[model samples]
Target: MRRLAFAILGLFLAAQGQAQSIVPAPPQVAAEAFILVDAATGFVIASEKPDAALPPASLTKLMTSYVLANEIAEGRLSRDEQVVVSENSWSQNPVFNGSSLMWIEPGKDVTIGELERGIVIASGNDATVAVAEHIAGSEEAFAELMNQHAERLGLSNSHFMNSHGLPDPNHYTTARDLAKLSAAIIREFPEHYARYKELDYTYNDIKQYNRNKLLREDPSVDGLKTGYTSEAGYGLVASAKRGDMRLISVVLGTSSPTARKNETRSLLNYGFRFYETARLLDAGEELEKPRVWKGQVDYAPVGVLDEIVLTLPRGKRQQVEQRVALVDDIEAPLAVGDSVGTLTLLLDGELLYQGPVVALEAVAPGGFFARLWDIILMWLASLFGG
Candidate 1:
C-alpha cells in the first residue's frame, strides 16, 4: 500500500487578529454536495458534505482513467495496443440501463487510445469495460486496482466496485476525493488530459459530444467528466483555469444534468472570483546551501521536493511570507532526498502550509585529513556560539 508521503514541518506563526472577509459566502447550490479546491495547492476554498460517500455515477471513470494513465506511464500498457470488446462489455443487463455508450460491436478490436476518447468524450460504458478487461482481465479485478489506488490517494470516504459506474451499493466517492483525483490526473498525466477538452468524438460513423456542458458554456473550463444514473443524480467533476490559477469543482447528486453543470459552474466561478494561488518555490529551486562537515563536497544544496504553491484571498497575495529552519549542522553521508530542514508559509501571522526541505544531491565522506579539519572547525564554531 504505497502512500503519498511528505515530511511534516511544525508551524510556529502566531495568530493575529481575525482575518478580514476576503471572499464572500459561497453561492447556495442545488446539488446534494460540492467542493472547490486549488489544483496546485490542494487547498479547499469552500465545501459542503465533501466527505459524504454518495453514488458517484459515471464520475467513477476518473479513477478508471487514472489507472489507465498510470499503466501507460509505467510502461505496462500502450495506447496503440488493440483491445477486443467482450460480450459482457457490450450487453447492458435487463436490470441495468446504462447511460451513454461507444456502441462497440462484440468481438470488435479497438485501440486503447480510441477507447480512452470514447470514455472521455462519449462517456462510453462499453469502451470503459473493454479497457478494463484488456488491462486487468475482468471488471472485478480492475476494481481491486481502483480501490488500491483510491486508498493510496488517501480517499478515506471513497470506494470502487466496477469500472463503469453502473449503480452498486459499494461503489461510491466523495466530492473532495473526486477533486483530488482530477488534480492528480491533470498534474501527473498532462498528455492524456487533453482528451478531456475534446468536445465531439466519432466512432463507427456515430458522433457524440461530451456531456460536461461547462466546456462549451465557459472557455476557462477545460477537461473533466459528468455522470448520471437513477440512483446517482446528475454529477460532474469539472476543472477550469484563469491565468496561472487552476481550480477543480465537484458537484454530486443533482436533480438534472443542467443543474449539475450549473452548480459546478457556480463553484468554479466563486473560486476564481474570490481565491488566487501563487507559486512560492519551484521544484529543485535551491533554498539553502549549507556547509557539510567531512564530505566529498563542502556544501549541500537543499530545496522543497515539489513546487510550493499557496491559495489565498483574491487580494492577499502580497501578504504571504515564508521562512526555513535548517538543521544546526549538516554532516556527511547525506542522501539525495533526505529531509534536513523545514519550510513554513505564513500570512497575516497565521500559518498557511509547511513541508520538508530535502537535500538536492548526495554527499559522501571526505578524505581523512579533510574530515579531521572539519571536525576541529565544527568544535571551534560551537565554542564561539556560531
Candidate 2:
C-alpha cells in the first residue's frame, strides 16, 4: 500500500512539473514571413515561413554593406579613400521616392565613410549604386559577389540580382537567410555593424533620419535595416540586445511600415519574455580528464573548442543535464585539438546539443618502460573491471 501511494505521488509530481514547465505558444505574427532567433545560440525562438522566398526590398543594403565590410576586412578597400560618383549614381537617379538621393551628384568625390553612412543611415539608392560600381565595376558584377557570399553563408533561400534592393522579380531572400546574415554582420564585423545605429546622416546639405523607427522607440533596438517596395511590402530586419542576449527579428511583406514595426516588437517581446539564452560552457572548459593509454601523460584533458550556448524556456536553465561519451581506451600520441569524445546536453532527456570533445593539449608517447606499464595496467583493468 505504501509503494502504490509513492508511485502515484511520483506520477502526480511529474505531471505537475510538466504543466509548470510548459512554454506558452509563440505570439501570433501578421506578416507574409517572419522569424525570431537568439543571436548567440542561433536558436529559433519562433518562426513562420522562415524559408519562404520573398522580395527583401532595401534590406538588400545589408548584403551590400556586408560585401563592403568584407572588402575592407580583406584589405581590398579602405574607409578613408574616395570614389567618384558617376552619372548613373547621381541624385537624379531616382526610382523610389523617399530613398532617392543622398545628393551624390555626378562627377563628385565621396569618401567610403560618407557613402557607407549614406547607404545605411540615409538609405540612398545613389550611394548604393556608387558603391556597387566602384567595387565591382558594375552592379551586375557586384550582385555576383553578393550571390557568392550568400552561398558561402549557407543562405540557401536567398538570391541577389542587384546592389541596391530595388524591386526586381529575381531578387529575393528569405527570413531565415536574412536572420543569419544579420547575425553574421553583428558577429563578424562589429565596427561596421555599429553604423546602423546612427540616427541621421547629411550629404550635400540634405539630412534625413533613419527609417528604422524601432531604434528610436526601444532602447534595446540598436541596429539593423528596413525595406519597402510594392511587391515586398514593408520589411524590417531588426536586432535588439536586452542584456547579453541579443535577438534578431525579420518581418517581411507587411501592409505598412507601422505593421512591420509592431509585428517585430511582438516577436521580440515574446522571445525575451519566455526564453533565455544560457552559455553552458566556455571554450576549452575542461569537462573531463580521461586516462590516456600508451602516452606520456596518464590523463588527457578534453573540452570544446567553441563555447556552447542554448536558448531554453526562462528559468529552466538549472534543469539541464550534461553527459560525456568518450572512448574507454584513449590511446595516444594525441595532438592539440584531436577529437577525444562527444559532449551532450539534455533537457528532460531531449537532446539539445551534441558536439565533439577535443584534446586541450598534446600528449606525447611515453617511454618504452612507461608504455609497457600502462599496457599492463590497461590489461589488468579490462580483466578485473578496475
Candidate 3:
C-alpha cells in the first residue's frame, strides 16, 4: 500500500460563506403516508408514515409495468409482438364499476408497446392483464413475477397479488417502497420511462388522459404513475428532474387524485429548496500517482472504482471535507483494481461516507538490482521505524 493517494487529509473549504439556516420543516400533507427522496443519492429528504403498509391501489401497476419492460429489455419479449386479450382481463375493464381501461376487446390482438403505453398512461387494467397473460400465461403467475421484482428491488414492505392494482388486502406497498421502486424504474429504463410522460393515450378510439396531473402543472415533472381505488383512496409515485438533480415523491392514501398530486408537489418543492445533490468524483479518475517499490513502473495510479455523489442540506456543502488513507509503501506485482486505500468523506467534520480506493493500473516486479535496492530500503526503513 503506497501512502500515495487515498488519504482523508484536507480541510477543503470552498464556496461562499453562506450562513447555515434550519431547513424549513416538512409540510403537513393530506396523505396518510408519503415520502420524498433524492434520486441520485437515494437520500430520504422527508417522510411521514412512509413505511406504513397500505393498499397500493393502482400503484401496483408500477411493478407490473416494470416487469414487462424488463422482459423487453432482456430480449425475452418484444414490444411489437402481438398478445391476445383474454376474457378475464376484459372483465376487469371499464364495462364494470368504472375501471380504467384501454377498452381492449376479449380475444383481440394488441402489441406489447401499445399495452405498455396503456398501462403507464391510461392505467388500463385490461391492457395490464393482457400483457400479464402474454408474459406469464395467467394473472396469478404474473403477480409472482411482480413479487420477484419487488424482492429484487429490496422492497421489504411491499407485496403484490395482481397485475393491475385492484384492491386486495394482500396486495399493498408503502410510500417509501413505492418511491424506491419508481426510482429503480426511472434509473434502470430511461427509454421505457418516457412513456409515463404521455399526456393522453388512445386505444380503440377511446382517449384517456394520463392520471398523473403534475406533468400538466409542473414543467419539471416528467414521469411516474398515479393510483386510486375506493379502499386505497389516491396514491402517486412521481419523479421530477431539475438540472442534474432528480427527486422522487410518493403520496399514499390521499382523499383524491388532486390531493396526491398536491402533496407530491409540496414534497418535491421542499426537497429542491432545502437540499442539493452534487457529484463529487467520477469512477476511475486518477487521484494520485505514487512511487512503488521494486516495480517495473516507478509509480502506480490509484482512484475510486465507483462515482461519488452527495446530498446535503442546502448551503451546508461548503463545510464538507475529504481525506485519503493509504499504506506506507506500495510493493511490486500489484494488480489493477486491487484495493489500495480508503477515501473518507465528511460534512462539517461528521463522517458521511467511506469507500475503497483501488489501483488504476497494474505494477509488475522490477529488475533484480531494483528489487535488491528496494529490499535494502525496506529493511532500512523498518530499522528507522518507518
Every model's Cα RMSD, please?
5.9, 5.3, 2.5
- Which scores better on lDDT, 1 or 2? 2
Report backbone clashes per prediction. Answer: 0, 0, 8
Q: Pick by lDDT: which candidate is best? A: 2
TM-score, cand. 1 vs. native: 0.82
In model 1, pairs of residues that clash are none
lDDT of each: 0.86, 0.87, 0.85
Name the runs in model 3 displaced over 4 angstroms: 1-11, 14-18, 91-96
Candidate 3 residue lDDT tens string, 1-386: 34533333334455378455478889999988989999988899899998999998778888999998899999999999988777777845443358888888876678999999989999988888888899999989999999998999999999999888887779988998998899899988999999999999888888899989899999999989988888999888989998778999998888987788888898899999888897777878777887789999888888887888888887665566777777787788999888877888887778878888789998989999999999998899889887
Single out the weakest 10-residue window by summed lDDT for candidate 1. Answer: 1-10
lDDT of 1 at 269: 86
Pairs that collide, model 2: none
**Candidate 3 positional error at 200, Å:** 0.5
Score candidate 2 by lDDT.
0.87
Judged by TM-score relative to the true structure, which candidate is superior, 2 or 3?
A: 3
Task: Return the clash pairs for model 3, or none.
Answer: 6-324, 6-325, 7-323, 7-324, 7-325, 8-323, 8-324, 9-323
Q: How far off is residue 248 in model 3, in Å?
A: 0.6
Question: What are the runs in model 2 whose C-alpha is more than 4 Å off?
Answer: 1-19, 94-99
| Reference-based TM-score, model 3 | 0.93
